[model samples]
Target: MASAARPQGFTDDIVQRRVHRQRDQFLQCITKEKVLAIASSRRPGLSCDYFKDPERGSYNLCCFVAFEDGQRWVIRIPLAPCLAWGARSKLEREIATMQFIADKATIPLPKVYAYQLGDGLDPLSSFVILEYVDGRPLSATEVDSLSVDERARLYELLADVYIQLRRHIPFHRLFDDLEGLRPSEIQARYGQRGVLSSATEYTTMLLNLSDNALSNTRSRILDQEQGDDVLYHHHLFRRFVKEDWLDKRLDDGPFVRVHGDLQPFNCMVDERMEITSVLDWEWSRVVPVQYFQPPLWFTGHSTEFLALGYPYLRYLERLDEFLRIMRELEVQKYGDDLLSQEWEHQKSSGGFLVANALENWTDIDRFSTRHINRVWFRGTKDAPKRIETFIREDPTRRDLVERLCRAHEIYKKELQQLDGTSDPGDSATTPDPFPRRPFFGTWESSVPGIITTTLALGSLIIAITFGVWKKRNL
Candidate 1:
């Protein structure tokens, strides 16, 4: 399709400023010839313009290149010498993975317009051109502005996206190759005894976070002085999912071909609130489900979905939306009963396990400060006086705490049992599979644009919900 022209408020000069200021950093990595080619090839009718992305800290610099012809593209140019080696490889893998997903056309993913390596600019100055998806990010805004319907719709959309990808993508096997390490092998290398059990060791290793910051940082957000306590919360969340039967049975319980980074920033929407495109696959990975699940650190409260970011509101909503879409697609492909059973299994086995795994989250101290005080307390308003009394030093709340602890324990036990039955070393380990054909065409056609028109509607619905809730509750 031809590019749309720039909007009136967005002047060419303004666009140029945005490009050099934010997008030029990435462009700086490319050669003068390559830049000229990209710039010269600018579609005459394109509407969007290119601007550097200041938010990224990775190898590739991102430029928002939009043309007068309405061609909005997020061009990525790698700064490293080797595109497929070391940290740069991570970005390469992510691009490959996203390209793979985009070809499927199953969900709303931004289309990959063009990609090339060996440009002779930098040793590794590879570049990828992608569709410029429209819509404001859900994460950038406040929740109170969203309505109930929007919240529900957002959840529905999120579920659709997750289900589509999960059904088609064998995440575990992908990670095995991408990381060049098998699940059992990883466990053996990292596993420890005692204070660090099998699961705990794995969590520590795979969290992808530095040890000193999490374990030794001076920050005292949680009442507990120990970093392990903080790590424990993350540990519990991951373990809950990893130990579940449904996840284990699929391949590696913890791993999948996930959006690896399905944060709000990656998603795009149209004016109708539909999902227009899911951008940025640089963080895509075949990692553990816990790694992909939204960050659910609250003890008892629910925050507005957008603010929770990854593996929290966004993750859950994404997963939820994916499943819904998968059900429809599966029902069309196979039959309704098969999908029904799958959903049942997920909810009863893995989904229930997820809830159970989160049981420990109610321990007030384990929750992050935002979730603990704001979300948790707000959710338990009915029992606020009693809860408050307990917080103030009453011993009775200890039992409630114990109950939360016990629930967490039971959930943890279930996960352990799920894990015990499966051996990562088993011969029948799942094989990693890739699509045989190029995602779009025989490698000649431009990948179709991924624009979910529903996201705007979803966001608007949430804004409405917030208003209604505030009016009624206040």
Candidate 2:
């Protein structure tokens, strides 16, 4: 293949600015007396069809070059400054981990050529030189573009990949802290009897934290106080949930690696309809022995203006099928009984969204465009007219849904009983109580006390005044 010329116009300056940092990082990682600077040729026929803003601006700018010796390689320069808070170091370590897995693991992950931490163009920038796999990102469009049998075959191949990865790479060894420990030793240290045990613990902690955070945020909103603590707790909870959930549920299991950002778009299918390559390991982590079902965007809307096809629901269905296959595989490997046990544990621990405060839920209904808030039954014309229409048409589903809604209403009334019952007189206060320290922690840590104390003191003058204030505002 002939080497293409440099891309034109404004893009030229951007490339020129980033090139120095790319080369610098390369030199730093691989100290060679002599280095060959690959030409920056713009590869045609591909575009980044990213729906969301690529976080950290870590998009790769590369030109596919087939050298005179008929060697095909991609020279990729990653943009974005090294984040101040040691994220660059974390990323560098991750790159090393990926290289280690590629070389040692049974699975065929990306082969890394070189990783360099750069300076000049984008200081704290990093560049990775890798062997470019020839394929397109996977999505419903790409899957539908293939024959039905081909799609099934691709999924089967992916399932096999998961099985092999889980079997070969034990979860404890994949993460930090246990990098040097033998799997058995690490398991002993964590008191994890097996992969499932660790996963259950991790998932349970994260969900509980999320529940507490959401509960606190709801309380603050109800009291009409814009306390920074409430907002901070919510943010912290979201972060913890994302990290812990990934670690325990996805990263802990050797079976399914949480391909952190997998949503079909990061997958690629070759001419043979096989997944040629999985792209973007930026968010990739070892996960539970399940198929990929990564989260979607907040609004979960697709950009129609972009020429690339968008089939959101179809992609979700495909993902669900993939997860189902993994679940079946896990059941086959262990027992259907074990899978059921793990699932039941997950439910009891609130691994899934169980309850929502009526007020908070109403806010979501009024605000969110995400599918979770999709209307099941509403008289509004603004949203999609499906659930109501379905209820109007189907007798059984409508009746069952109505019964469920009534039950939910009853639950709501039951919750209100404890709203104003707190009485501090039940416990005496001590004098000079350490001069009340400055409040500076998260809502998760504080809101529980606030709610409890507020209710307990409702008979007091202060509590009565606050209640009157709320009523007056109402």
Candidate 3:
């Protein structure tokens, strides 16, 4: 007998169909009719027939169920084998966390109607029933057509959410109880389940998470040079943390729950200059205040382009404006503006780099390119030379890097085997930090520079040819 094959990812049409099929299955017992049975469980006698088309995200597939009683609810079905601690457990945690936030914080969140309870939801044991938020996600190109003032107001609204998540959440009581959980379980849920004594402990836990993410081969596409990146990345993060460049007096106290993926995509905004509801609470966790910074959507591009020019410059202007809004909101709310005090480091280059270290630890190549290659060395052109100089220039840094390399490689290999991946035979692996991009193959990240250089060379050739033609005519 042959076993069924697994999906490459949820992106495939077949996998998406299966997800839709699963939602359909939840509607009824194929053998029996349970259409009303499902809705009644959420709310007694609330009949539902029309289900909106499924909306898919990286981790979950959601379908909006509209009841005849003018009620709408969403069924969030977890994609199994989901990244980090499996899908079922992660979804359960998200449900618990969302419930906690809704009760404690004044933030607008979708209510969880039925999860891990009720025999009516037996078919959807793997899914959660949530209240459907009415609004559009700001990242859905809806905010682009907004007027300048509208955009400013939008940033202010977003800053309010950030302030609410940090300020209003009753995390102190939760931390005091600590869930009666073991230190490992506590650490699993929150970064500093115990109070972080120093920067090293905090950053080391970040690296550990990155290593765990890498150990899971399913989290990323198999890159041959993946292991090489850890040496430089781990070294730079630690060194910067030790110096005042990163984690400056920010650890040891007052850790709060951060909306881990606090971007426009996860935030739903209405036309009335109000943020209706914030979504994607799965990755949210309690961490040091410094980890929470301005959202990435403010950067204006997918890749973090620290280089000056078209989009990066716009990001700087928007970022300052956003921070100004946050400062004002903090003052009004707490009268202390303590949250603004920590973000002073966030405006620095070291802050952004260290931030990438904490957040993008799972994706080391991205951290290297955006934080180190782009920001530190300027661009791809100077990356190799600058990186070599950086490692070799300082003896202490060099020793630290060597230790990181050995540790990263050994752990990566052990985890690789655990992921059922054999040695990739990467003896021929190049020291190149950045991998081959999709469209351009080996094309440089500096596209504007390439275009400008091409035009300059074309002009030079035309001048030389014209001069030769004049000499021949003479």
Candidate 4:
């Protein structure tokens, strides 16, 4: 009998459901005795009632332990499957980042009491015990409803945090430690970890997604041996990857340690509107200073507000004011020249905006037209000419030109179908067809499996091509 067919695409629902099951199993394994033991270590002779919080993050399960003395603590467990490729390293880094911030900065952050890096034997074995912060997340309504004074105060507080964070300089050699560990030790400690050393490395990782997509398509084409579908997909991704102008701008930078996922949801504010704790440090990395200029959540709202009938113009106005205050504060502390230098780069190349868009692509409402056009076709009316130049640079890539043109037509048709319009040209202002909701879902869920498959194929091709070139030269 034939085996059951595997699903072709990774669905958001499937990922979420699987993650949910893992969370449940982990929770079930955490007995009352274990919670009591963890809590008693912090507070001697303490017994507490523990319950899972309804509010859970994508990568963590939160369990609240209430002591008889009315004190509370949170037990956070890392959901392994929910994490991307390197779960162990990410978990360790997060612990290190939190500890570093707690020691070095005055920024509000949860104090970790104890943690266990679980071996894969048991689901609930890994856990982090932290002081339960008393505050709620800043809601979207609050963001939209904040008065001028409140917003100004919030921005100032955030700026202070950034200033303090900047004082803690990144390692000279990317993720290397100040302890002077050996190269092998460093590799074992940090290699394949999420910590990036430079802006160029970050950009390459982002662009490599497209390269991988193309590779996958090429492989599938070779495997089945006769499909234009994969070739057309490859052309589209290749065009995106070959945006050399944008690539060049990302290569220059003054690197700094960044809170890689600093958004409204990751921050907790008290009823009095003060930031209580900044949570989730898993995505933190060393990156260019310009990357920290635009607020992650603000830039992510470029098209989202338009879809929700919110006044995007008002949003932009508030955003400008927020940025202006932050810049003035940065200038005052770091001197006019240091801050101005980064701002100049941002204005000259539009690199800051492009970088912000790239990092927050998953949150972006319209990925293709808004992000791709804004970055690659900025100030230029002749985007086709730029694409033609890319094609002309390599005779081997010339075959992709027609395929790319054909892919664009297909893309237009897909857009038209989503917009319910017969004329694709007239539907430019339509709402985003692929809005990623519930923010926790992986980008892989939204993207088709074929894209991932193409990426693997592309890597293989590069390796083979390099081998051939070396053989010929030798």
From the highest TM-score down, the ranking of the candidates is 4, 3, 1, 2
Badly placed stretches (over 4 Å) of model 3 are 1-36, 44-46, 83-88, 117-123, 140-144, 170-199, 211-230, 307-313, 366-474
**Which residue pairs clash within candidate 3?**
none
Best by lDDT: 3
lDDT over C-alpha atoms for residue 124 of model 2: 25
What's the lDDT for residue 147 in model 1?
A: 66
Quantify all predictions' global Cα lDDT against the true fold: 0.39, 0.36, 0.50, 0.49
Model 2: runs farther than 4 Å from truth?
1-59, 82-91, 104-106, 118-125, 144-146, 173-256, 286-474
The collision pairs in model 4 are: 212-455, 215-454, 215-458, 216-453, 216-454, 216-455, 217-454
Q: What would the per-residue lDDT of candidate 2 be over residues 216-294, giving only the tens digit for each residue?
A: 2222232112222222223333443454333443444444444444445455666686777655555445433432222
Greater TM-score among 1 and 2 belongs to 1
Error of 2 at 329 (Å): 6.9
| 185-229 per-residue lDDT for model 4 (tens digits) | 323433465355555655555545433333322212222112223
Residue 376 of model 1, lDDT score? 35
- lDDT tens digits by residue: candidate 1, 1-474: 111121111012222222223333333344434554574464433344335332222234445665665556766555442122333344445556665675664787766676554445353345666666667554524232456566546655665676556556543222222121122333355323111222233344443222221222222222322222333334434443344332433334434455544555455655555666666565454444433343221112233222232325434443454455556655776465343345444543224224222321222122332233234345324433433443446453344344444544554555455456565432122321211232111111111110011100000000011122223210
